[model samples]
Target: MKEKHTWLDAVWRILLYFWALTIVFPLCWVLYESLKTNPEFYQDIWALPKQLNWQNYADAWTDYGFGKSLLNTLYYVGGTLIVSLFFTTINAYALTRMEFKGRNLIWGLIMLSLFLPGVNALVPQYVVMRELGLTNSIPGLILLSGLGESVFYLMLLGGFMRSLPKELEESAIMDGASLFQKFWRVIVPLSTPGIVTVAVFKFLGYYNNFMGPFIYLSDPEKYPIAVQMYSANKQMEYTADWVTLFAGVAISMVPSIIIYMLFQRLLMEGATMGAVKG
Candidate 1:
């Protein structure tokens, strides 16, 4: 049994190493390519650069408008994070813990909506945005996304909230904690792992979101990194500045990597919060 278990573990380890290579290799290749000039890149696609062309990054940053787009993205993403986290936490707490009329029914309806295709709502959403005069503005986009409830976030947070002991809330109540106090003080603090997990996931999604911003934001100044990179890539078809494009692509990946590295522990803890029994 021990021998078999050891062999199984070895196989899993090998697979994991291969998977890591698949992800890391492309990222390293992009970083390497970003360091080359056009002539060096054209001379040898696979070979290392003759000299590090740091100018490509500078050109990508200023010429490609990554600086402005990055700022816009930070504004959009930061606002959405604050608003969505607050609302989602409240909604999850109410759905999972607070007993009220039609709570299950509401949850059931929300779950049922999951079966419907989201693409179908694009037209109506666009129309509403137009009517509300929200198109082409970052704050408008923030409100649109933040106000929208995500089923996946709800489910992840609800599961974590459900796993908390009712005794904690009872203790808070005995001490005369009000409804908002119970949630803001007792629940929010306890659910930090789950909230952080949701935050990291949402950050990735918001950062990479292309279609929403692309459809709504027509101004180049308002573009997020994803949309900006895409526009730059299209321009590359004519200008053929592949190295600079690579540089922008590499720069665009930095935030996601940093966010994942920082919050990875909390993310892992939150992921398993519901599975482990107290």
Candidate 2:
């Protein structure tokens, strides 16, 4: 039994190592490629740089207009976070905690949206934006992104809210707390984990958004990092300045990776807490 267990443990360790490598290797390769000159990259695409070229990042930053793109991405992400979180939390609270006619029917419709592909709504959404004269505006982009209350986030939060003791709200009411106060003081504080998860997901979606900006924003100055990166790649000459392209890609991804690492623990807890309790 001891011998069998030892063999199984060894196999598991090897598999874990392979899994780790599978994830890390691509990131490492990109980092390496970003430091190589165009000639060096073409000469041996897989070879490590003879001398790490730090100037690649500087060139990419200025030439790709990453500075402006970065600012635009921040605005979009921040707007999405504020708008989506507010609506998602309020809607989730109402759906889960308050008694209302047709509440379940509304939830059922929202769940049905989960089955519908986002692409199906593109033409109508575009027409509405055009009719409103908002096709090229940042506010329009933000509104479009925030229009759909994310059912997945709502459901996750609802499950978490359902797991809470009903007496908590009842006690608040007994103390003469208004419905607003009860939700603000008691429910919101307890639902932090779910809120954090929703915020993180929204942040990522807005930050890396390509299709929305691509379709709606025609002004080069207003383009976000993802669209800007594509523009940079498209303008590359026959020689293909890979170093700058890779650097641009790396810079674009840095904010996402940093945000994920910073709030990963909270996200994990929020995602799993409801499941564990349920």
* Best prediction by lDDT: 1
In order, the Cα lDDT scores of the candidates are 0.92, 0.88
Model 2 superposed RMSD (Cα): 2.2
Which 10-residue window in model 2 sums to the lowest lDDT? 1-10
Model 2 steric clash pairs? none
In candidate 1 the C-alpha lDDT for residue 57 amounts to 93
lDDT of 1 by residue, 101-149 (tens): 9998999999999998877888899999999999998999999888888
- Predicted model with the maximum TM-score: 1
TM-score (C-alpha, index-matched) for candidate 2 = 0.93
Cα RMSD, each candidate: 1.7, 2.2
> Model 2: per-residue lDDT, tens digit, 6-77?
788889999999999999998889999999988999899899999999999998888778878888988877
